[model samples]
Target: MNEQYPVLPGAEPFYAENGPAGVLLVHGFTGTPHSMRPLAEAYAKAGYTVCLPRLKGHGTHYEDMERTTFRDWIDSVEEGYEWLKERCGTIFVTGLSMGGTLTLYMAERYPSIRGIVLINPAIDIPAIRAGLAAGDELPRYLDSIGSDLKNPDVKELAYEKTPTASLLQLARLMEQVKGELERVACPILIFVSNEDHVVPPENADIIFRGVRSSDKEIVRLKNSYHVATLDHDQPLVIERSLRFFAKHSK
Candidate 1:
């Protein structure tokens, strides 16, 4: 994939060393590390080793995203997770949107994951089905779904156009993931926005019901939108996540 557009300044991957416990932060589809930076920094400051890797085809031009598949994104996260595993005593995974979906998949596959935090995880989206129904008749890309923050001032560094192929792959991956929730035996903390524009709030219920984790917790965001990590209630996401980690990642 060609880098038609230059990567944004703060959107680059972020890493910091601190405590023995490692935290892997993953960004969503079409999003850069910028969206997850605040939480990563918070974890870093709290004395945890944090690694935020830019997903393949993301943080670059929209055209390049079409060249990638869902596996590519997951591969990126897996690589970062392996890097953290070597250095950290315990590893926790957290992500937003598609990132959250990937986090769940990782937890299911990697029993080594100590815990996970998900923000508006995209287990299902009607738009993906609609695009699939349209098939080849649909355009190569669609309008942006970024910056769905309740706080008007905050904006996510995401693609202006959504890649159709990538979205299709995302849907397929979610279908596979939703069925394997029982495999996620680790502690999980999920934050969902009641007014999410992109992911239906009921997706959270589906996940809560599906996951076998006895320590699973779901926190609803009354004032935020889809991108709750960068919204008005962002601090709550960070604060609650820290507490959850402390409680479960011992």
Candidate 2:
């Protein structure tokens, strides 16, 4: 049964505690934390605390995700953030795709966040809205959005099909986050993939123009796709992310 779907191997959330500076790593929609695990491990090796939370219906069957709303996923990230708050003195958030949407939501509400790092964050996917506007009923499932990595040997542990119901929630979440982009006052580092297939590089530009942060900058990822965390430039991601964290940390 979908309700009893097991958590797939390597899809479990990642958590490690060390120094007073903490980080929350978030995976994209339909993606498990496995893609973010490598980054989490690097943070742990550097002696910083790390928390990667699995979304409410993710890391399970697509049928399970069909039953969830965007708010449910936000709740999951909220729990992870609160857990870090109790154990660390300063906190930064980093996310991929939809995870980046939630990171913006948090940064808007909590100006206390030291900063945020987003890799190809999915925002305002026109296809989703265009389909709905045309009044075409979307199929229950669509082609997968996973594993958009430039590295041929790497594969992301994500759902093979996307639930159309969840796309609605995602659209709503993006709209809400986009409306409040001006509220993100913390330092921001956004990664843009020049040849991303999943999320257009324009998202990086939109976020760059929207936020009011003085310390914001965009890093172009030349060798990766949407899921840059596991792509060819993964090391550059880890190195730049660590640098961003250090710059914002007190």
Candidate 3:
């Protein structure tokens, strides 16, 4: 059952070391670390150790993704965190979409996170539950969730199709994370696109209202869509995140 899919060049895990401040970048479901490469490079150049690991079933074929569970995805983030912990004195985490979900999960599970930044982090999207309810009635896969950027020239290197089983698992994960949002007390910065097609904008409100963090702010992206990491507001995300990290750094 090794179905082959086109693996895009440069769509692989990335890492760099420059200083004691470590930053972990996590990509979304069906997405490769390539989506976060520019951000990672920016952080590295700014004198921070950056680690972006390809999540368990992502950056490969859709068939491989179908075989992965949410636990497997989070495990990859944990591994990346451990790797960064070994090289730096302080750590920050940021993610996009499902990556953001894992970032919140990590922030709650590990109190060592100095700060948190999330771009369109998925929590309880209605489509996810709808798709899960439909279950096996739907095809093994659906249209790709990639390339949600409003900048038509920019394309995300992600699967062309979405796996149904994995989507169900993701729905479950979202529910679980929402329940534990109170545990995420780290300083947080969140970016939400007002015109996102893949994830509803309300998800951001849910997070902002649920988290118990004393220092948390939400920035609405006026020009970008779901994949704001590679969109027009990318600079804003990077700049604000760097500031947030610096403000909370030890």
Candidate 4:
């Protein structure tokens, strides 16, 4: 919701001009930057320049997502990373769900990334893979997968209906990302929800085992669900991430 483009209320991408050290926060598929806004603000508060970009085809409407692909979403993240790289000598990347996937993608390509943080990164979802394997004509829209927060009071500003074709791209992205996990050598701090209903908890294990980052830690979120960033353990997530960034950014 910044000056770059129009977005729904609370969905605008935000940038904080703070320092030579920056953090780029990416949101998940079918999700707007609102999901990652809290974390972005947290990073900004710590005097780190922060960019939380609204992925293409998101933060507007589900129908808009139909015209997009995973590559488009990736391009959005790359743009944000470039913004940070231009201004910040030390850059860190962090994401949630597919955002985390993109974060890993960034590390795979840019070995200069100081560190990374992931919340419920979705690498391999079996149901999505099977659906792609079927090759059957899929419905144009399906039930929403957003707002999977453990706290009933808070809700994620995600799409109400998921574009079916996007799932295929997600599967493709996962395949592409998981194959290059060994190339992600940046220090990583991963958060996994123990009771997530969206992406399986096994994803954490896969990432932990797959990433070549000798400096990696996986913390289980027992008090949260899929969107742990807005869940009960959010404070913990923010605190741990700040510590991780500080440790590596130095």
TM-score of each: 0.97, 0.97, 0.96, 0.96
Q: What is residue 124's positional error in candidate 2, in angstroms?
A: 1.2
Task: Indicate whether candidate 1 or candidate 3 has the larger TM-score.
Answer: 1
Worst 10 residues of 3 by lDDT: 1-10
- Output the lDDT of residue 45, model 2: 97
lDDT of 4 by residue, 37-100 (tens): 8889999999999999889889888777877888998899999999988889999999999999
Q: Which model, 1 or 4, shows the larger TM-score? A: 1
Candidate 2 ranges beyond 4 A from true positions: 1-3
Model 4 backbone overlap count: 2
Task: State the lDDT of candidate 1 residue by residue for 15-93, as single tens digits.
Answer: 9988899899998888899999999999999989999999888887878788888888888999999889888989999
> After superposition, which runs of candidate 4 have C-alpha atoms over 4 Å from their true positions?
1-6
* Error at 11, model 3, angstroms: 1.3
Quality of model 4 by C-alpha lDDT: 0.91
List clashing residue pairs in candidate 2. Answer: none
